[model samples]
Target: RVGLVEWEAERHLLMLDIHHIVTDGMSMSIFVEELLRLYNGETLEPLRIQYKEFAAWQQSEPVKERLKRQEAYWLDVLEGELPTLELPTDFVRPAARSFEGDVLPFSIDKQMTDSLQRIADENGATLYMVLLAAYSILLSKYSGQEDFIVGMPVSGRTHADLEPLIGMFVNTLAIRHYPSGEKAFLAYLNEVKETMLGAYDHQDYPFEELVKKLQAPRDQSRNPVFDVMFALETKEDNVQSFGDIKIESYPETHTVSQFDLTLVISLLDEGMNGQFEYATKLFTRNLIDNFAQDLLVIITQICEQPSVLLKDISLNGQSEQEQDVLEAIDIIF
Candidate 1:
């Protein structure tokens, strides 16, 4: 048994404990709704197929051929000396990394969220693109590297049958973003949008299949290829109720960091809610909180003036690159 919840309300107010192994974000929602409906004595349609069938079919011949087309694209995207995010850890990492994690929650005000949405719409991009750009900007600033990779989870329900059934119908994809040219936040948004579009177009390739194909250099101290994950969750995760007993779900973060860190951002009526999951082995709450605040600042400023140089977004004044660029400009002038 991976997890259990003490249902004795006297001892423990309404709570849930589930192992990450059995369910993902999407699957948990399905499980809850189904349980409620079943308790209310409502008959439901029979499941077309279960997880076992889906797993078996994934290994079939035709699917393998289809996935081949994606191999070349993933390989090219991940090419070069793929380095991990250069986040400074508090201590030297052990030979084998631990999975302890912590979750820091924060919210972006409605005005900033709306501004970002407008920017996204104006640019023919989704809010995901806008948020991702801002996130990439933060990573860029922290690591001081124009190019790096971040993982994003995709609902692997490419087939219609897999949608209604509750299972691990999700896959994690690595997005390797390369900041181009003058590195204005606006242009970076466009770059991220394009990458997102490509990822969607090629979403059918199973993540494991892609990772196996890439053969990324392994580092036991961290995850292969990418060490950070970013997810943008939507309305599907809203609070559910069966007439008065409202049950709201919040992300559960712990002492382990899965792949250096995982950032989960959810869209809410008030604004965007962000949960930063970091490894306890490498960071503290204060540091993660500061990073989260900085991200909000970045998002706020970028939407207000998208054309601003990436260097200008720096919290500690101009970055080294910004100074170098200024020096060149001064010499030329």
Candidate 2:
């Protein structure tokens, strides 16, 4: 669906709303790129493969065999009892899950960003690995669960042909990690990098298929496998100008949360910015605001001292005694 609202004589708002079933984050960029080319009277080459052809290929025997092998890997990794995160909520969880949510925005300065990148480089890991390691530690501290799963999205455009096509070639990976406080930060990060590499190898397996195969008991109030998700968005300038019309994106007021909590980080030229999109039914705004601040604290501490034990890290600059007092007073948020 597309709409254009005129805000002034020379200004307008263009809204392009597409369902997630047909397009993803990567596809949106492709769509906008082609849209601009056509708007500027530039011709685009015909797609090598249409969406239907790609769907058909997925159902082919060879793809089926490949998925079977990948399924074995997922099952082995997620074998035995699954851990459910028990994060303390501000309100009682609803009988049914709610999509109502809000975003808490935050940013990391270029200095810290560069430091993080250095750590990633020293450890032979990507920035995503470094951030994910820090995020896992925060979740462990909050939920008091050393082992749990966090959903990560993978761009499932494995083949070059699929890249130019605007379709839903995105897959969710249930990445489980055990963040032990006793372990050194660098050691844990390397472990996370290894686990992520393995998950990426089997990322082609559909998440829906994994859920069906796992046959876990359904919970109406939460998502299966993982309650929280994390994603790092690589920067892309999708639409620049439509023949000097000065095209740009317009922000929307309505927000939705597909999970209990989702942390999205975007790598920009200036630095790294992030937002925590969380379900309002399960968290207060103040609580999530503190989460954003505390996350930055965790990242700063770990980046400065990679050898620091995870347990030594502090949130919101609170000592253990102070944290306990706040918990006792029931005013931590």
Candidate 3:
């Protein structure tokens, strides 16, 4: 019955220690919600399956076969492709190792989210595709490369058996989008939808194994493959309470990873929330924040004027901070 408690710090940070056997990201959310109820003197329904059951189920035969086939697909599709995007840099790029940094988060409004969803539905695509396409375009503009690569995480739970059992089942799929001159939004959306569907169709492959199969040249100079990753997580079952104790989540500071950079955007009924986690050694917090703001502006502009030229779109509403960041990258590399 390890529960929440406060840590001593100038700023607020909540701490908790749940045995690894009992919790994961998904379960932690639920545990928090339960804690809240209990602290307010309420009870909760018992969980259907303990964590070990889920872990054991994940090792079953069907899961293995699915993973094998997915690996084959990834090996074939990703073969011979340059694993990394050549991002323009102002300084000499650092070694291949990932660095730690901070996360800058922000959100979109409900009206915008609704509009984006409606457009996605009408276009016979998904909100995810729309976001991916926009990100591709942005990468192309920033890198001066027409073909852009981005890594996205998929739930990778195609079968009913795997849905209830979660153990790092998320697969990172590499999407390569090559934008042609003056392509229409619907056309781009169609391409993105197809790419996403194909990736989903073969997403059981573990990302680490796929990278090995691709023989992606390890570059101590930069990230091995893609420079950016996008993740969308919308659901969390969280409750917090314990006896007469109430619990609330204070913001937590996240250490950045070694990967080039990752922008995780989540959509809720209310709006969209974005978190930019980058290598502190590679980029300053201000640079990452500017990129997030610029991305929001780009998405908004595309929603209003999807037909705008790619170059024009990238250069739109360029703030001094963003320009400086871009220029710095350009000068460094």
User: Which candidate achieves the best lDDT against the true structure?
Assistant: 2
Tens digits of per-residue lDDT for model 1, 173-282: 78988764367877878888889888887777877777677777777888877888899888554566686455666454366678777888988888878989988888
Regarding TM-score, does 2 or 3 come out ahead? 2
Best by TM-score: 2
Show model 3 residue runs off by greater than 4 Å: 1-14, 17-24, 33-64, 157-167, 235-245, 307-312, 317-333
List TM-scores for all candidates, in order: 0.86, 0.93, 0.77
RMSD of each: 3.9, 3.0, 5.8
Q: Write the per-residue lDDT of candidate 3 for residues 135-217, one digit (tens) a residue.
A: 77666656667776788877655665544443444557887778654676667778889988888887766677777777866
The lDDT per prediction is: 0.79, 0.89, 0.69
Q: Which prediction has more favorable TM-score, 1 or 3?
A: 1
- Tens-place lDDT per residue, model 2, 1-333, is 899899999898878878899999888888877887888899999889999999999999999999999999999999887888888799999999999998988999889999999999998999999999999988988887899999999999999999999989999999999988788899999999999999999999999999988888888998998999999997655456667767777667757899989999999888888999999999999999878888999998987788888777888786345667878889745
Ten consecutive residues with minimal summed lDDT in candidate 3?
235-244
Query: lDDT score of model 1?
Result: 0.79
